[model samples]
Target: MTELPGTYESYWMETGTGPAYPALEGETEVDVAVVGAGVAGICAAWELARAGRRVALVEADRVAAGVTGYTTAKLSAQHGPLYAKLRGSLGAEGARRYARSQQEAVDHVGRVAAELGIDCELERVPAHVYAESADAVDRLREEAEAAREAGLAASFVRETGLPFPVAGAVRVEDQAQFHPRKYLLGLVADLVARGGAVYERTRIVSLHEGEPCRLTAEDGAVVVARDVVVATHYPVFDRALLFSRLEPHRELVVAAVLPAARDPRGMYLTPERNTRSVRTAPYGGDERLLVVTGEKFRPGEGGPGGVGERYERLAAWTLEHFPDARITHRWAAQDNASTDGVPFVGRFHPGSRHVYVATGFGGWGMSNGVMAGRLLGDLITGGESPWASLYDPRRLHAHEVPSLLKAQGAVLKHFAGDRLRPSHADDVAEIAPGTGALVRVGGRRCAVYRDEDGGTHAVSARCTHLGCLVRFNDAERAWECPCHGSRFAVDGSVLQGPAVHPLEPRTLPDEGPSGKEGSV
Candidate 1:
């Protein structure tokens, strides 16, 4: 079945047949409540259930349908020159703790995949961060040293199997990759079999923080639990003003059909160039597919050549390197980065006893997500985890202040700039079919999309989250806020959000286009 043309459709979601889960209908209670059904929530549910605790896993959509489903799924600790940067701020031991936690998560996933008899294409491959430029080679050398100090099996390898040449690379041994959705779905099944409950189409509208936090759903169902884990990719709460501290970046992913003989034998990423991440997934029984993802930008911003241009760039890159490769499927993913360059994984803040959150995994959600599971699971079970304080949401770093201030300034600029001048076009027919544009009607800005059937969808251009005007993200055919990472469908439905409310609907002008015939 073909998905909507411009909407975000992940290859993993289409290919994997995940298990069916029920929706919460009435009042429910559990020892621990998980607020999202991605890997982090899956891990928390699985861990708590395995430890003889009642877990009610609630998802706004189907299981593994969130960010974890769309990930490139590299289970490597070498997240693009991260340790060297962390060592400066988190100190040697703190950085080592971070690396150790990620390594443990990788090891756990591999072990669990085998334990559950899951055939998720799990492969143990050495991961490499390669550099093509001389200066980049120097940086790679320093990163190698940092990786070793942080307890990774790392070395600087001058020779790599990349189809293209590289000056040098940091090779970390025994890192793994797998079909993330399949692996997590296997865990989800195991959780259900072990007497855990999972609910889909259960959107948490609000959470009352107290003894046994109460989560009120959009449909008016309530779940009261001793502990609540908020593992939604971007934290749902804006109380901390995280919109300024955490920045969102969107990247294009393209997977090309390739012959089975073309195995790169490792997961590879380049930090110097346009930041390409490369790996392969098993296609049929005998064939393999190569995946490359890069070209980062803000959510609402599309390339000049159009929304489809980003896919073309990746296709061009693939044919250049591997001439026999054929373009197949492609999509986009939104990743959030903490200003301080680490994740916020423990309690929502130091003062909170029952509420916890896992967010800002940056682009490396796989390992960090699993680590968040283990960390949060331990905290809920009252176990002393060594990495707890390092990931505390309330932990303040002096370095992140400037970044937060700069991000807020950008938000203010976009908010003010969007309202400076309203576009004069009012007719719905002015918008071409299969495209969307922002225009003013009745002196109010509204986002308008014209479908191939000549139907128009119009909604308030102002984002519901913080009043920042959203822009038309042509690539995804959705409304994306540049300020705080909230997103909505063209029809005003909330997609991703710190915003619980949808965009306000607006009626368009009746007159189509103003075209007229001239009488001579």
Candidate 2:
């Protein structure tokens, strides 16, 4: 096995730990209830609180410690060559709305950070989408023009700050990058100081929409609010069939320490090689943490060597680009992509009056998350937002049908096909130490992992979300549902979700000579 560098963690998570909040114990009432304490949730709660609305920000875990904690933390409006594609799919005006919304989000982060005196290391830098091949240069030029037309300070440039030469690039000026947790924690504090409530370790299991929305947490505590915002990375409550329209993707990130002089000094992205995103953050004097992200794949599909190979590829790419980089941290991030490129940020469903949802950021969550906060606040406060029409969940374009079908087709493949496939091991003894596999115990399929001590732990193979068989991700050491991106630990605890319930535990039969004695 090839040795991979860096500790298996996120750089942002290691540097900052946000404040802890008490879980909801009994019935509580608020004007608004925001689910999930990620960037979108915190920002939404902050927005409502600032508007003088009594708000409760509830989270299953620590604030900003889920997808937000694992992000690359690039606060930029220049989302690759998105403008050009939007121009074609949506008209010129539609593209302009997206550009304006994202740019406003970018500015909003900086403004909020400065106003709150949060030392999030926020700094202005130009964002670039560069192309290394001649064929992609023309596309970059087109993108540059479309971006400028859509109201961004964009230009096509041949020279970039990268170590390698690029054929051409679309450069957008005045974008920024910062530490997400620091900024969000600052917002969390302000939300509390402003008479808003935040509850950590409060998992909302059910939502009842009415004149006043009722949310029930895992502990049976209830939160009654006039409005509810579902900001969980994947909508835990999929009333509008969002699971069919949203496709889940997971990406690997590798960060390394490099001399400040070697820092790129700007955020960069490229469409080549699956997808590559590059940014840097202040580590200490004369050194910067270079974070590189790429290798996108579905949750349960690990391609050849599982997620470990994806991490290896990302690390190799980082070393190839920045030889002086000494890898320090590595982790993975997940996001949902809508059938249409635009995110669904307005009403949760057509019938929903007070319930709103924000999902399908499509890997550009920082700006989109902030945009969701502002948009959701405006919708709840009855303030007019011009971009609301573009992100409305009910609006469906004819162009989205093909993509939607393709996404659902893949889901169907995973939902039914995985169960028919051969099990990983015929007997528990065939499983190697420190590895997991699907085995049949008492004529029932079970996901069993063998510890180095020869003890066996088993859970049902069926995913709680949609009956999809869970696959073991060797690199992350977790079982992942491919259909909708739910994750579980070896102990059958929910890690990430559209699935609120943990996998069902199963007991193994008595072991023979080949099987182990101890079982869980």
What's model 2's TM-score?
Answer: 0.98
Please give the lDDT score at residue 24 for candidate 2. 95
- Residue pairs of candidate 2 with colliding backbone atoms: none
Q: What tens-digit string does per-residue lDDT give for candidate 2 at 16-107?
A: 87667999989999999999999999999999999999999999988999999999988888988899989999989999999999999999
Residue-by-residue lDDT tens digits, candidate 1, 324-393: 7776677887789988989888888656889989888889999998899889889988899999999888
Worst 10 residues of 1 by lDDT: 511-520
The lDDT values for all models are: 0.82, 0.92
- Pick the TM-score winner: 2
Tell me each candidate's TM-score.
0.95, 0.98
Query: Which regions of candidate 2 are displaced past 4 Å?
Result: 513-520
Q: In candidate 1, which residue pairs clash?
A: none
